[model samples]
Target: MCTLTLAWQVFEDAPVAVAANRDEALDRPAGPPDVYRASPLVIAPHDVEAGGTWIGVNEHGVFAGITNRWTERDLAGERSRGLLVADVLETTSAADAAAHVERTTSEHEYEGFNLVVADAEDAIHLGWDGSLSRTAFDPGVHVVVNVGFDETFALPAERRDLGERQAESARAVREALEPRDDERVEGWLERAGTVLGDHEYGVCIHGDGYGTRSSSLLAVGERTRYEFADGPPCRTAYEPVGIEGQF
Candidate 1:
């Protein structure tokens, strides 16, 4: 059981928003976000592997999201999950941070995984299968799943329609927030909820066997905000929260 779903790193006039849903769940682990938490700003319901994290944010406005790098099992490393989270938050730049993670990962053994790291200036995607590494992300919105393919891959006809729908939803979200009122944060949240309404990205739910254990909505930028709630409905009624301590 694991969480699988799409995440949006939204930048509004007020604050950046990280909104996501937990697709599935296995055994709930004991952690800071009990729901989801890692060292410092790293926050996710659980690790991608037994010891790896899937999504995390640092107090420094550094954020990362990891997905299984689907590939032949031949490539992997021995890096601990905790180390991965720690390395990114402590590093100053995405390139330096990626290098630190890649170097350490090469020495250790682990499963295939893709990590998305972002700071105020840049966002990077790192694909690793233990033996080889590739970086494939720039700025702007990108979608990731449990599959391996660059952004250039042509979408199937059916998927193209789905993509259009998601894009439209995303656009609507952007348009609705054009005014960016402080009180409208709630409206923005509602719009986000509406955009994701009834859309199940399968990966997150994973065949009912694994229901999302937790879900998170995060916003970064000048003032970072993180909101967490249980999965399925993916609510945000709780207080608008911030990561405690420094990265």
Candidate 2:
């Protein structure tokens, strides 16, 4: 299981932030970010065999990522989540991408998952549990977990207000990037720690057994950057690695 977070500047020309963690069998051969000929854009370490990605961006100013929802069975065989992300980035506008994913992947049998996609024009969130549901994003801060719920799940009073705090902190970072201020950038970076402080597995072994196995933060601008960590209060950017092939 994994976690994916995004922060977007409400008043900037095209400022966006993203963070994610790629959780697999732990023994899978994964590469870092690199440019490929088919898509011919920089993509995060993608599992060629699996045909999906944790995060990636194209020169056309499009970005996309995926988070696996904790469910009873594996969904990999039903549809290729990575390919879905890449397809959206390469071919569609953010406004209609979610529907495309839903319509295309509906026939395949899968567990469940959420996808976050963005472009200069719009951003979208999609939740699929063999069925498809989606919501368009307004300019601001938002977070997506593996729970298959929208912002509603983002707040839970019982968690010591952790979810609310994280959401607020994420918004702060987005505001900081509006003017692209260094101080604000630093401040946002610092606050990012607080937002991700309570990182937990997407699936709890003691409970659902699908707790978050990793977390990530990604930002896209003139250039795209990514940071990943095991638990919340996540810090550090990962070096890009290269992957080959295209679907």
Candidate 3:
């Protein structure tokens, strides 16, 4: 996931709502949302090149997503960060998942990343840029980009400058996004799709052989609801995925 907007504990019925866009190279192969794990019923799209996912959710109502944190140089991580998202999803609850991520990431090596793991009970943001840090934030609307919007971390001058330049596109999108009229998470997802697709906000990118590739909307409450757009949200329509009421 390149950019993620989460409305945690903002709705009356649904405690979590998310609108996320995955930006990647055009040639990178990927599949739409599907059943990846059977026991707990994990739903996520596959990064065909890496055999992992950028975002996913489980039957336990746990949601996990990752966004790359821009660095001065483009370097491949020893391990794909998306796999970390998958690992955290295996846990039953958000807090447990978060603790697992903290321990695992501290022991392993991954490139710069901003990770969000959350369920109705807990929401945690973990940022890594050669170092690791964890943050707990209040419930409300939050936007995370490559540089990590609300989840801040110390950085070298060069790296920070690079982030300022590269992360502006995602920040622009967040600024231009309008609030949803209705309170329901389902309604917010529909409204988010409209604005998220608009190039005017820089949410939908048309770059040189690289741009926004896929989108996901999730609402977690008594029952979980998920919808996915296989292609760029601007040109593709979202369809329901997983079991309608659960899973």
**Cα RMSD for candidates in order:** 5.8, 6.3, 2.6
Model 2, residue 101: C-alpha shift (Å): 0.6
- Give the alpha carbon lDDT tens digit for every residue of 144-230 in model 1: 443433342222354565444434443443343343434444455555443433344232343445555555556566655566654
Query: Residue-wise lDDT of candidate 2 within 1-247, one digit each (tens)?
Result: 4445565564243366665545465445555555532554545555667766667766555677887664444456556677677677665466666667776775665556678878767788877765666777877666565543334443323543544454444344334333334434334533554444433322211124333344444556654555545422334333333222321
Question: All candidates' lDDT scores?
Answer: 0.50, 0.54, 0.79
Candidate 1 shows a clash count of 24
lDDT of 3 by residue, 1-247 (tens): 3778888888877787889889899999998888878878898889889888999899888999998886554545788898888898788998998888779876887888888988888888888877777888678777787877653533456667645644565556555543456557777778788767877656677789998999998888787888999888999998888667545
Model 1 earns a TM-score of 0.66
Cα TM-score per model: 0.66, 0.67, 0.89
Top TM-score prediction, candidate number = 3
Q: How does model 3 fare in lDDT? A: 0.79
Ranking by TM-score: 3, 2, 1
| Over 4 Å off, model 3 | 72-76, 151-162, 165-182
